[model samples]
Target: MFSYCTDPAALDGLAWFSCYLTTGKHMSIYYAVGTVLLLLAITAPLSLAFGFGGATAARSQILPLRWFGNTYIAIVRGVPDIAFFLFFVIALDQAFEYLRHRIKCPDWEAEVWQGNDFIVCAAAKLPLGNAPQWVHETYGFSLAVLTFAIVFGAFAANVLFGAMRAVPRGQIETAEAYGMTSRQTFWRVIVPQMWVYALPGLSNLWMVLIKATPLLFLLGVEDIVYWARELGGTKTPQFTDYPHGDWRMWYFLALLVFYLGFTKISEVVLDRIMARLTHGQAAAAGEAQRKAAA
Candidate 1:
């Protein structure tokens, strides 16, 4: 990383450490932390939105909608998350390319699938074959985000569906007696009350989501885990400015601490949010708060 790092053999001590951390590969690894956080920030809300929609659909009177929603929720719980991540990313990428192929090369005479290979026309390649490096990276990251959202959304749907059901039926009846339409009662009465019931489940889901971010490496994203392994491995002096013994344990230790800190902070925030959501409600948490106040 240092301009003085022109010759690896010439450097030693602090200069070597300085140059080692500043290397291009190491810099990219540092930036990969941001990639993980970005994935979390974007995926969290989108997943919740997907969950809410699925939960609503599951509760719908329409038979087909309920079936679809139930299927979505059931599939995730039944399947291992790693299996979904692996299968979905490949399937989704191919699905996109196939759609693009049909749209862009309708006249192509050859079949798109040859043996195990899924070959699409050059024009149908995602981000195009000649696209910039960043475009390819961005497209891959977007797919990863979508994959994470879909998988987690199903779990969230289950949690939210139960929360919706746990909202007392009396609340809905009371709203109906007050002349509220089904829509008004759902939004005003059921939705608001369900959060108090839902907070614990949602908080657990959030912590799981945080823990799952490391799986980004599986999706081919250069995430922190990938970097940790790469940078922590011993390198010969011929290949790097700073070469040393295996330090993977230390790097992983840092990751462990990072996650523990993140989850601890999340626990605090979720507790505050739960308290706010339960305020003045009829739930045990709310009752306890009122008792403390009295």
Candidate 2:
């Protein structure tokens, strides 16, 4: 926000708008946009890592490992994501506090759950009763991040499992025939080759992850959607120097633009990755590269 303008009345049309958009609340709105982007950045890799592990687990010849992996993917698909988010955040939070309550307030226990409210000792609070506001915000954000990672990680695992299976089985056998150990063949051959098949599903999952960032609001994370709705509401001249009409539509539009720009960039990046993945494979993309080279 520009200094030199002490009063909102000093600002004219566009300046008024700029000042309005740059208010502390609006600055938080801007940060909220970053918050959503950072969420996608964090969730994407973490989900991919999880998916890889889960896919590996599901593929194991060992029955118990396979059952566990398959069950993880299936359970998430069965539950509604919103329900999982709602239930898990509170459940996880309370679980943490309950554990803390046991450790911290072992002597003074009047039951953790008294009807609807989850009462924990002051010391057992997630951010503590007297913690800074920022600490609470950070804690909420951490929960949101964990929620996103867990939900999307399951979906990613499903996609990756399919991708791993879609890789030609003969190639793995060929590696075995060449005297490569099972683990060596998995890393050196199957793992590297699986991406060509994985890219399509993973990219789609990424797009879904991008759109789902708005759900952070439902989790009380005060993300862009939350701030946009808050600051974009009408403000009276009596209440504030800058008065405005209902601006939720405008704020939502801005969010739409932000998401579109993010997805466009993601598309470009995923395309590049796919290009690299398909460079020497027997897919049409690899054939085209060969043709060009020839």
Candidate 3:
């Protein structure tokens, strides 16, 4: 980044370090951190929406609807999440490719699973065999994000489902007494009140989602972890213009700090939201606020 970094070999001390870190690969690593943030920004709302639908399904008045919703939430919780990430990405990908294969290569007579290999015509490939590098990365990243949304959505659903139940029965009863129908009671009385109770669990789930971002590396996305490992290592003359000793520990230390700061910030924000939600409620926090006001 600095003009003095022109000759990495000649540059010494901070100069060599600056040029080394500014290399294209290192720049990619830096950009990957932003990718992590982007994933979180996108996934949070998507997951919340998924969770809301799941919770609603579980509480639906219809028997089959309730069973389906409950089953979706229950099955996701029952399975190990890593297993789901691995299986679902591949399963969803293959399913996509299979459907494409069916249409694109109708004349081709090759089974998709021939023994251990998943053989499909090149025409059915996700980004196509000859597509640009960016498409492949985009495809992989999309799958990773989808996987994250699915897994975290399930956890959020469970939290929300409990939160919905936490809404006082009398609140619903009072709504009905006011001539509100079942749907009206749920939407106006239950839905609005549930957020306060759900905030704590949802906040915890948010922390978990933050921690889980690193797992994106396993999904083949070039996230911060990938960059930290790639660029943080000692460079030899053969590998780069600047040579250094082992520094992965320091790189990972940075990652730890990054995560800690992120989690702490999230905690502060959630706490503030909780306080706002508790402003006039009959919860403990609300009672404390009322006493302080008096």
Worst 10 residues of 3 by lDDT: 8-17
* Winner of 2 and 3 under TM-score: 3
* Tens digit of per-residue lDDT, candidate 2, span 275-294: 89888879877898889989
Worst 10 residues of 1 by lDDT: 234-243
Tell me which residue pairs clash in candidate 2.
Answer: none
Cα lDDT for residue 266, candidate 2: 93
Judged by lDDT against the true structure, how good is candidate 1?
0.90
**Least well predicted 10-residue stretch by lDDT in candidate 2:** 1-10
**TM-scores, each model vs. reference:** 0.95, 0.94, 0.95
Q: Candidate 3, residues 189-241: lDDT per residue as tens digits?
A: 88898999889999988898888888897798878887888777887888777
RMSD of 2: 1.7
Instruction: Give the Cα error of residue 242 in candidate 1, in Å.
Output: 1.0
Clashing residue pairs in all predictions, respectively, total 0, 0, 0
State residue 280's C-alpha deviation in candidate 2, in Å.
Answer: 1.7
